[model samples]
Target chain A: MSLTILGCHSATPRTSAHPTSQYLEINNKRFLIDCGEGTQVQLRKYKIKFSNINHIFISHLHGDHFFGLIGLISTFGLLNRKNDLHIYAPTGLKEIIQLQLKTSNSWPQFDIIYHELKNDQSELIFDDNKVEVYTVPLTHRVYTNGFLFKEKIGERKLNINAIKENPEIEICDYQNLKNGKDFVTKNGTIIENKELTFDPNKPLSYAFCSDTVYKPEIATIIKNVDLLYHESTFLKDRQEIAATTKHSTAEEAGKIAKKANSKQLILGHFSSRYTNLDLFKQEAETVFDNVVLAKEGKIITVDNKTFATELTINQ
Target chain B: MSLTILGCHSATPRTSAHPTSQYLEINNKRFLIDCGEGTQVQLRKYKIKFSNINHIFISHLHGDHFFGLIGLISTFGLLNRKNDLHIYAPTGLKEIIQLQLKTSNSWPQFDIIYHELKNDQSELIFDDNKVEVYTVPLTHRVYTNGFLFKEKIGERKLNINAIKENPEIEICDYQNLKNGKDFVTKNGTIIENKELTFDPNKPLSYAFCSDTVYKPEIATIIKNVDLLYHESTFLKDRQEIAATTKHSTAEEAGKIAKKANSKQLILGHFSSRYTNLDLFKQEAETVFDNVVLAKEGKIITVDNKTFATELTINQ
Candidate 1:
């Protein structure tokens, strides 16, 4: 799985900063998360294929989280998209989006399905052959929920040398072996599948959290993830303000990352007052060694391991 | 009066091109016209102060023309704006915007008044002390209207030399001269105001037309305006496509300007397919001499006498 950061700023728009939006590629399927304003333009700047975005996950109705959604939907209509598009968002998003279409009298040519999220507890939202998505209830001023995308463990890789040596093994038996199932050979000999094939690679996972306060209880839901993206809207000095506004500071995000035992922590949703993002990384690094600041057009991979790359900003 | 091009492109988002949006400064007051997606960012990029904009005129319900409006209004609420905002648009816009706010559960801190345009005839939408705005009925796939911004004729300028020659006139009498009224002295001497004050400066006007077909009837309402902005969604080669879609080609826009006898013509909203913008200018220049392409961030000034300054595109 690969995660691409379309934008990762907070609050108001600045010359160099953007609001929150991310693109995750898992098993060749693309998922867009939290489309802030100007996200469509950023998508074009990063050369992201718009048609590839089959699903959009909006954490909340905050303007910074999903303001760009309507524009993206409209653009899809203008582009004459034919493929069905799915949106998983808070309950109210459907009414908001549908009203715009109704008033404008310009509905998309494609089918747009909305899966309204109403529960506060963790629940499976989507489960495909390759990935499973669950919600992480978050504390915010408004109804909000973070999403956890976990890749499903696939079949084990067969040892070619071991397989070739067992010529008596039927081709159908190889399927059981690849599935890590013990098999009985034609000679009545028991073959251990573990010995015939290597153990299946560990499934990687990523969790996205934003526009919420620092809640320690979240650790249970996002524990030991490959990558964790947390919103750091303020610095440690503004902890009181963060509490009052239901936001998180850099230090608080780091604490969450530490408690969750995540492999790496990515900090984003910075306050517009912050001119230099180095402070966000520096502050988070104090608590977590593996910390990276989220920048516009940064891509992260989540296959077996997590990695990140910055895309060019010129576009 | 000054016209600022906030965004000008057709259909999808591009790095170098933007959707349709414009800012017009008439009589020193700002008015936004056709706020497309990302318009607020463009407004910031051009250093146009948002606080001055009390009125917004949406040309049509097309997403390209008005998608950014809700976001802009939300941003105003975020910024804690106290000024009332007036929006004049097609009949359904009020409900669409209100529904979005209702679903989001975030009401604007400021009052938002709406004036829905229901008639397909010319009607005065706004009249302030210094300017008057009238809607020009347009032809389009959807309900659309063009706007004519005309600066009210100002007080006549007094020729100081001519005024000094007649010193017997009281300062109060000078007010009548400025109003183009003749003054009679106590000695029964009559002096023509025309000899004292220069002729009232001609009121300059600007007309904005977009997302409309090639309709010659528009020329009647926008006749002899100082500046005219017309959408050119396609080139001459795609004239048939433009007609079928209720859009106009560069040549068609130029013809409208020629027929209206506008002082200057600005052609924009080019289709994304056209990589070279010179084709629009070339096609328009064939019919109108003073033709300019409306690039993002381009600014034009319209004085009471004439329109001037073809601005180079800002980075």
Candidate 2:
């Protein structure tokens, strides 16, 4: 799975700093999360294909989180996009979008299926053969949610050398071998599935939490995730402001990452007041050593076996 | 008067190309017109002070015209602005903005006064001591109105030398003399007003029109404008598409500019399909000689006598 940080700043989009938005690619599925203002432009700057993005997930209804939704939806219409767009956001998003479209009298030709989330508990929101997405309920100024993207366990791989040695293991028998079934020879000899097939690559998981307070209970739901993206809107020095605004400091985010036992922690949603991002990484490192600061255009790639081997940390 | 074109593209915002948005500084008044997506960032890019902009004029409800408004307003709240914001838009805009703010549950400290427009004729919308703004109604796919910004006639200046020649012109009579009144000597000798004071610098006017069809009647209302910004969404080769989409071609924009007797014409709202922006200027020049194609960072400053002397044309 690969994650592209389109924008990582909090509150406002400045000259080069963008608000919250991310593009994730997992199991051949593309997902856009938290579209802040100028997200469509960020997508263009990063060269992400607009048509390939079929699903959009919004963490909250804050302007910095989902204000760009209408513009993106409108652009898709002007491009003559044929695919149906699926939006997973808060309960009031649909009504607001519909009101804008009605006011303008320019509705998109494509279908927009909205999956409004009103549930207050962690639950499965999306499921397919390749992946599963679940909500991580968050505590914020308004109703909020964090998403957990988990890749499903894939089929076993065939051991080519082992299968080649057994002439009775025909091409048709390869399917059963991949399904982890034992191979039975025509002469009544049986071969173990482990000997005929290799184990599948380990599945990976990423947890995205933003615009939320320091909720320690979140660790239980996103435990052992390969990558965890947590909002660090402030540093260790502004703990009081962090609490008042329902935002977490870098130190708090690191504590949560450490408690969750995540393989890697990606800190983002920085307040524009801070110019030295390395301070966030340093503060996070005090609690958790495996921490990386998120920056616009930074890419983080994670695998179950290799872990976060390819990461563009913003120092 | 100075006009900054933040974005001038017709439809979707692309790389280095923005949608419709402009910043106008007339008589020390800051006004934002047509805030498309990424406009706030563009304003920041151009170093325009956001806090000084008290009035915002939205042409229409189309995404390309006003999608950036919410984000900018939200940013203003985040910055803790104390000045009230005045937005002049369609009737439904108030409801839509209110819905988003209500959903987010983060209301700004300052109040937003709405001057929703439903007029179909040239009626005054904003009247201050220094400037006046009127709606220039246009035919489009939806209810849209262009804005005409005019600098009101300023107080006449007193010729210091003429005042020195007449000791009877006391300091207390300066206000009357600045009001275009003649100086009367204590000996009952009346002096002509023109001889005492030179005429004030000619008042400047600008007419903004966009996302409209080829409507020649627009010239009657915007006659003799100092600067006219007309939409040139397409070239003459795509006149059929322009007509069908209710947009104007460069040639049409030139014709309108020529017929209106505008001193300068700024051709903008360009389609993204065109790479050579000079072709638009060329097409416009066939009917109007003083034509400039709009670029993202283009600044067109107009004066009464100097005309379009400080212009940064794309080509």
Best by TM-score: 2
DockQ of 2: 0.85
Candidate number achieving the greatest lDDT relative to the actual structure: 2
True contacts kept of each: 0.64, 0.88
Query: For each candidate, what is the lDDT?
Result: 0.86, 0.90
* DockQ for all candidate structures vs. native: 0.68, 0.85
Error in Å for residue A282 of model 1: 2.6
Off by over 4 Å in 2: A312-315, B312-315
The residue ranges of model 1 lying beyond 4 angstroms of the native Cα positions read A170-172, A302-315, B306-309
lDDT of 2 by residue, A90-137 (tens): 899999999998898978999999999999999999999989999999
**lDDT, residue A34, model 1:** 91
**TM-score of every model versus the real structure:** 0.96, 0.97
Ten residues in sequence with the least summed lDDT for candidate 2 chain A:
A306-315
lDDT of 2 at A287: 93
Instruction: Give the clash count for each candidate.
Output: 0, 0
Candidate 2, residue B217: the lDDT equals 91
